[model samples]
Target: MLIDIKGVLNLWGSFVRFTDCKGYPTMQAFMRESPQEREKQRYLPRLDDDTLAKVDRQIRKLDPAGKAKAYLANLAKPNDKREELESLESDELQFAILYLRYVAGLENKPIWQKLSLSKGAFENELRLAERFVEGVLIGSEIRLFL
Candidate 1:
């Protein structure tokens, strides 16, 4: 996989096919990777603009004693990164899903009004979802995904 925005969007279904870690049996399993392992992997995608690249991705060895501390610190990440999408309100989440599944790619509009989505609301939630997914992709760790 290219690990770009399109690649991240393609990872919508349950399983992430390109990584070693398989289905997320437990979120803990995803977060339990050792710092050495983390240092050995490239988590985020390579930025297109070299000037915008992250400098702190350099290898670093943290003390083994701080494993718990590190785990506690990064408790939010997981194999399935739906936390942001799940955080949306019920109606917003519904509209976001409907828009992505049914409306986003079509250049023609036929039964769009049947969805009964308010223009302002649908577009608002759609943009919000877009930003949320982008943030998730930006922070995602490739090795931790399954």
Candidate 2:
């Protein structure tokens, strides 16, 4: 009277497999974490000598707050809020900064508007802006991606 649970599930177009009924429902969940969760999580890759040095110069000239402000400002969109934060998540902020640095250009409106960050958050982001930017640049280089 044993059933081929895997075969039955497959026939029903539900392909999850588990040892028993007790493990059934949870097997199909998408909440499983990505593979990189256990390892040291690196957001960006290594930069070439020229790019690395250029980035150093850029970072050196900017105070933490200023860099954060600038990086965020570069990401703000047209007609974006002057004092509102963007919807970008914590992890996405690093990528957004790269877009700001290598992709988006400056315009007539203030940089904060484009970055869509409130003053307080922008200031807070500055404290770690350099690290975020470095991670993105380095990771992007390592992956041969932008």
Candidate 3:
């Protein structure tokens, strides 16, 4: 296929600019990181087995309804201003927190009962939480030894 040099150069230049602004060596290594470097780039804080188990248990205990209320109440709140539910390790934290609030209202003696969420909605939230936890576990395990 015929390629456009101008477009390619522009894209490369944009990538270099982005990396350079982030204090990285720009044009040379912006998006062409070597396989070895890519392997090295997955550095995250090491989470112990115990920590993993703890998070698993916490996720299992998450309250769906409470999560819904929290999600709604915090809708108008800034991303970082809300009360911390748990220290999310990655994107998993995002979904897991939302799941907790959704399940909260389902409990008979729920923490807060002001809002009512549909049963389907509550289940969907739980599913999302499950996916998040799965991702967190898999991501951590794959990168833990790296």
TM-score per candidate: 0.31, 0.29, 0.28
- The reply for model 3, stretches above 4 Å from the true place, is 1-49, 53-115, 142-146
Mind giving the per-residue lDDT tens digits that candidate 3 earns over 66-138? 4533454564378688665532332333343343343222342231222244555545544565565555445
* RMSD list, candidates in order: 14.1, 19.5, 18.7
**How would you encode candidate 2's per-residue C-alpha lDDT over 34-118 as one tens digit per residue?**
3322222222233233333444444333333344444456445454545554465544453344334333433313334555666
Model 1 misses residue 61 by how many Å?
Answer: 31
Ranking by TM-score: 1, 2, 3
Question: Candidate 2: which stretches are off by over 4 Å?
Answer: 1-86, 107-109, 133-146
Q: How many clashing pairs per prediction, in order?
A: 1, 8, 17
Q: Candidates sorted by lDDT, descending order?
A: 2, 3, 1
- Report lDDT (Cα) of residue 146, candidate 3: 19
lDDT of 2: 0.39
Better model by lDDT, 1 or 3?
A: 3
What TM-score, to 2 decimals, does candidate 1 have? 0.31
